[model samples]
Target: MRPTVHDIAAAAGVSLATVDRVLNQRPGVRHVTREKVEAAIRELGYIRDVAAANLAKGRTYSLVFILPASDNSFMYGLNAEIRQAILRSPAERTDIRTIEVPAFDPAALVSVLEELSREKPCGIAMVATDAPEVRAIVDRLVRAGFPIVTLVSDLTGSLRHHYAGVDNIAAGRTAARLLGRFLGPRKGEIAVLAGSMLVRDHRERLEGFTSVMAEEFPDLTILPVLEGRDDPEIAHMLVADALSRNAGIIGVYSLGAGNRGLIRALKEKAVDRTLTVIAHELTAHTRAALLDHTIDAILNQDAGHEVRSAVRVLKAKADGLAVIEAQERIRLDIFLKDNLP
Candidate 1:
């Protein structure tokens, strides 16, 4: 049989109340008594059931999610998933709330993080901006005992507890391979569309895409990245202008949001030209584009899965328990027209 609190108390020559205080790290137990109880726990291999104890105490974990205020299908999908998680909050013993900050705004994100540090929720998850200031604030908050997780977009170098998102570099590399294979023996320029270089995910994707293209497909020249800020109108204007100006452009790789604009641009500008296009996210626009052969392939990370993983990791961190890494690992899902689900 497993050792219980009673066994710990008996082995430590302490009362039940004393053992409880020590186990919960609550005040009132003397240092010596705490040490004795800890020693007994180590000796007897006593494991505290954190879930049962929290349930008995009626403990509710308050968690905050910080998202970018980007007007795009991917962001909309992510918000919908968060809303679904909110609907299930009662059963999960979580109080989940979301805060939106302007996309690519480092100062605004830092201010929000500072405020959240003061509010001191049980855990925090954010689609990080990937700026030095943001990373500094995150590191400080983690040092101050906040269980922080990076969602969707991760911080490059920080003390964030976990990242509940796909490997963006791998996703980008996959996009390159798909586009390269689709464009078979062609020797023309490839245009890249992005939200912004400020976010780590976009930067990493661009890095992977460029490295693979340079190494394997030396015939394909990559044009300068068109930064659309993840806005449909901006992406449309930029992509349309790029295609109009560059007649040699043979492929499009959109490793970011704003596929709506990319699709519209491709339809309007590349009417006579046969441009192989690959994009991210499987939204309504992208799905239709894929069916119509406007897009050759799509690489996606499930918004619902990412949100759920964030909540699970946060809850486990709040309860002082270890999370199964394999369970929390979010995989990249590649979708073509035939594989759409």
Candidate 2:
């Protein structure tokens, strides 16, 4: 027999009202009491019938996901996940929509956020670039009672309710460890190609990579950053120029989008198989390049996981329910030619 909320309350040694508050994540419950109630729920295997709860509350959440419009593998993956969510919305009883703006443009993102504020969706998920104006816009949305979750990249010091992405700092450290070990004590120059410094993900990745390199692998020198803006043409041109200037470059770390340009530049320089290339995202371009020995490894964040996490957190927030942190955790996936999945 399924346990009732009353049973859960009895098991947790709390009053029925306290149990209700914990389950609904209402104000006035202490952290310790909340934890105790949650532990009891887990131990009892109590599952809240979300559909019944929604019906009882007369809930219909309208959710909007704002993404960057870029011709890159990462953006493509994110778009695919959003489409999947739209297809799955009927079962969850959600009205989900996606909006795309110009990539690497904080003003454009801010404008979209402001527009959404007027329209006032029940929940919002966005990939925020690090800018004071952008943060301010998110703050305004929060004050208006919209539950906001940051996807992929984060906006620090904002009222964002949750972050649905991997530990980027750990991802960076992992990348450095992989690159350093792969190179095997060779003293050589490494180039870092990023989408944009203005984005939090890029900056965090750079920080993590540099920290690992400084602490563990001081033999390799990282060259000045090349901003690709997630554009194939720009990435290709910049990489080619860098290669021409630095003949001893032995490794390349692509922490941004747009592998097309990187592939082209490597092929043009005839260094496709010579240089050890590590990049992010696993798309057709990166997959093919990996098979062809152009790219060595891929550090990827599953777009599906990010999108699903965002939806779950937003829905919970809208319902005034607590999120399951373990269920919503975003994991970093490391892919090589051997294990694609």
Candidate 3:
């Protein structure tokens, strides 16, 4: 039989109310009493039925997801997953809403965050835009006793409780290694297309890519990054211009959204066979590019997994419950032409 609170209270020599406080992670339980209740629960091997308890408590986690308003495959998928979460909201007793801010606009994000802070939702999960103002806002929210989760891109110095994204530095290193090997031992120049340096992910990826390229492949040269702002039109123009200037471009690494623009640029220049390209996200454009040999490899992070991870972290933090760190860690999914689903 499952251990009950009554049993825990009796074992710990505490009142039922005290046991409830300790068991449900409520505040004001003295440290000594919490430890005693915890020990008793451990001795009895008690497993908390969190679902039933939440239902009984009538707890509803109100969370807001701040996403970027970019017309990219990853963002689209992320928004879709949020909608799916909303569909499951009733069953889970969650009130989840999303706010779309302009892509790479730190000021706009800061304004939105400031506005949301007034409402004081249970928690907030956001795609962090790297800027001092944004960091300040995040710190302010944290100081105000809010649980925050950084999604997709993370901020450098902030009080965000968790991050629901890949290790971007490692991802960049991976892309560099793949690009280097795919290009063989031949010396050639590589061009990179990025969303924005204001984004930590893009910056980290560029850092990793350059570090690897400089250390491992000294013969290969990496050109300056072209900021496309996750806009296909901008990416197309920038990449097309880069290709024109550096006709010896043997490889391309797109470490951000805007693959459609890259594809359009490649098509406009008819670069189907010459270049070995690596990009992020396994969207339809990229997948089709892989199938047709436009892109050589793809490094993907599941948007759905990120959304779910953020929800889990926010919900757990809101309830002051410990989460399984290992279970919540998000991974980067790599896809090849031969291994794509």
Candidate 4:
């Protein structure tokens, strides 16, 4: 039989109410009494029943997750994950709400954060932009005791408690390595497409790609980065322009959303499978592109995994409990055409 709160109270010679107060860290318990209750807890190895405690408290953590309002398949996938989380809210006792802000707008993100701060949700999850004002807003939310988690893109010097995303640097490095090897020591220029330099994920991916290309694939020249803003039309135009200008382009690395444009550009150039293409995110577009030979390899971070991790971490932090770090660690999922999932 597992030990209960009553067992802990009795062992400590403390009242049930006192034990509850001590366990919850509620006010009014003296230091000595709290110490005694804690000692008893240690002696008996008493583990609090999280489910029961939550049920007794009747606490439903209200959580807000801010996502980019982009029409890209990646954002769609992330929104789907958020909807799935909402469906599971009753069982988890979480009131999860999603807010979509304009993509690549630091001011819009900051405004959303400010508004959410006023509403005072138990937790906030944001796909952060690299802006000082945005980081300051997140810091303010953290100081106000809100558990903040950064999803997809992280804000540097923010008070975010956790980051539910993959190591983009590693993902970039992997992409470069794969593309470099796949191109077979070719001496040609590679075009790099990014959503925006303001996004940490994009920046990290670019950094990693640059590092690997410089060290191992010095023969391959990297063209200037094209900011597509994760827009299909923008990506298409930029890629088409680059292809028209750079005939020696043998590889392309897209470290952002909006592969639609990339696909169109490649198809137009009649080099869909000829150039070694590496991209991020495993959406339907990219998946199909990979199958049809538009993209060679994909380095992905599961949007579902990231959303769920943020929720779990937020709930744990809201309840003043420790999170399972290993469980919450996000992994980079590499996909080839043969191993599509």
Candidate 5:
């Protein structure tokens, strides 16, 4: 069996990113790490010809960014990042176009994917809706020899070439731990606001949050998840309603976008009670809330980094080159009022 980069990563006890850096002769690696990877390569008798691989697959990429038509600040930031990538695409030898489908609408997204499949671009990157039909379309695209990369929200059980997003389960677990510590040992109910359970990212975050809360903070009970559809008005209404009904709800875990609404609802009830809020994204609204002590912590994934990473993955898959998994791994940034950038 031909040893792959995955095998090298395991043997060296290092990340794929380090292996790629070594294989491609890129900078940014410690001397000890480089020696370990080289030793592993020698032991396995492995050879890498990145130049030959690139020669076989010439550059000139046609990539598509299929994003949701969400009004939230996070989606806005994502689109902005894509635009920035487009500006830089010429030098990278890549051409990029973007399409927006209705947020949370499985049928709408399916129609768009089908249309793109016929065109057969070099690669397709999308924020997938977690529906069986959507998954089937992605599988079809992959089978048709198109490189499909899922961005932000992933499509599980599909033949996706790569995923450019954070580990949502870990994000949720972190949120739970922070909320538990902030709330102390007081007995109270917690409200979780999500975009929808249909998206894999949100579901994973919920699972992580619930599991950790149950194991560590028994006193903090998680209430039923409220689907806000990433809409500010909807989220605001749901939060207002939840707060009114359960006075014991002292903490909130917002696992999705639409935090503007959450902020509005919290502001309205800020005088009545200060709900310890931990939400995703570091948008203007969230930053303001954090500064004023309306929100305790902000869990963020860089929208710009995610878009650029997806582009790189798509280009690599199109060129039949290996991806640096560690380099492409999207980081989860934890933001506090003190550290606002």
Candidate 6:
């Protein structure tokens, strides 16, 4: 039979109240007494049933997810997964809410975060805008004892408790290697498309991509990045213009959303030319493009996994529990035409 708190108290030669205080990490328990209880717990091989305890205490984790208000397919999928989590909130004893901030707006995000400092939810997970003011506010909130996690995109130097997203630098390096290897011996400029440099993920991806291209593939040149704002119309126009003006461009690297516009531009403008393209995210547009030979490969991160991991980490931090790092590490996926899933 499993040992109970009463047994633990008896073994440690302490009162039941003392044992309860130690177990709950409440003040007034002397260090020596706490050590005795811990030793007794170890000797009895006691495992805490956190779920039962939370239920008994009527604990409800109030978590907020701050997502970017972008119209991209990946963002849509992420929002859908969060909605699904909300559907399961009742069973999980969680009160989950989402706040959609304007994409890449640091002032708006900082304002929301400051307001949340007053609101003081159990936890907050945000797609950071990678700005100094944003980081400052996040650090202030963390020092004020708010459990914070960065999802999808992370801040440069912040006191965020955890990050729930892919290693974007590694993803970009992988893209560069793939693009270079596919276009072996080709000497032409590569047109790069980005959503914005204000997000850490995009900036880090570009950094990695450029580093690899310069070191390993000296023959290929990366042109000035076109900021499309992740808008399909802007992406279409920018890419169409680039292809029209630059005849020496033989490859494309799209390290952001708006792949639908990129694909359309390739289909219309580069129909007579051969351009090897590598892109991020496995949306419908990118997947179809991969099959049709528009995009050579795709690097993807599971949106569902990221959302679940953020929720789990936030809850763990709020409860003052240790998170399993291995379980929370989001992985990168590479997809080609043959392996579409």
Q: For model 2, name the residue pairs that clash.
A: none
Model 6 spans with C-alpha error above 4 angstroms: 27-32
Clashing residue pairs for model 5? none
CA displacement after TM-score superposition, residue 113 of candidate 5 (Å): 2.8
RMSD of 6: 1.9
Worst 10 residues of 2 by lDDT: 267-276
lDDT of 1 at 215: 87
Steric collisions counted per model? 0, 0, 0, 0, 0, 0
Please report the TM-score between candidate 6 and the true structure. 0.93
Q: Write candidate 3's Cα lDDT for 260-289 as tens digits.
A: 999988977854448889999999899999
TM-score of each: 0.93, 0.82, 0.89, 0.93, 0.80, 0.93
As for candidate 4, its clashing pairs are none
lDDT of 4 by residue, 1-341 (tens): 77999999999999999999998789999999999999999999999888888788888999999988877788788899999999999998999999989977999999998888789999999888778888887888898899999998887677789999999899889988998999986799999999988777888999999999999999999999999989999999999999988788999999998888988898898454368899888877888999988889988998899999999999999877899999999999989999987
Model 6, global lDDT: 0.92
- lDDT of candidate 2 over 95-209, digit per residue (tens): 9998998877899999999899899898999988778898998998888889999999888899899999988888888899999999997888999999888777888899999
Q: For candidate 6, lDDT tens digit of each residue in 1-341? A: 88888899999999989988988889998899899999999999876678888989999999999998987899999999999999999988889999999988899999999899999899999988888899999999999999999998887679999989998999889889999999999899999999988767888999999999999999999999999888888999999999999999999999998988999999999999999999999988899899989999999999999999998998889888899999999999999999887
lDDT of each: 0.92, 0.89, 0.90, 0.90, 0.90, 0.92
lDDT of candidate 1 over 49-163, digit per residue (tens): 7768878989888999999898678888999999999999999898999999998899999999999988999999999987889999999998998999999988868999999
Model 3 misses residue 234 by how many Å? Answer: 2.6
lDDT of 5 by residue, 215-273 (tens): 99999989999999888999999999998888989999999989999999999875678
Q: Which stretches of candidate 5 lie over 4 Å from their true place?
A: 1-59
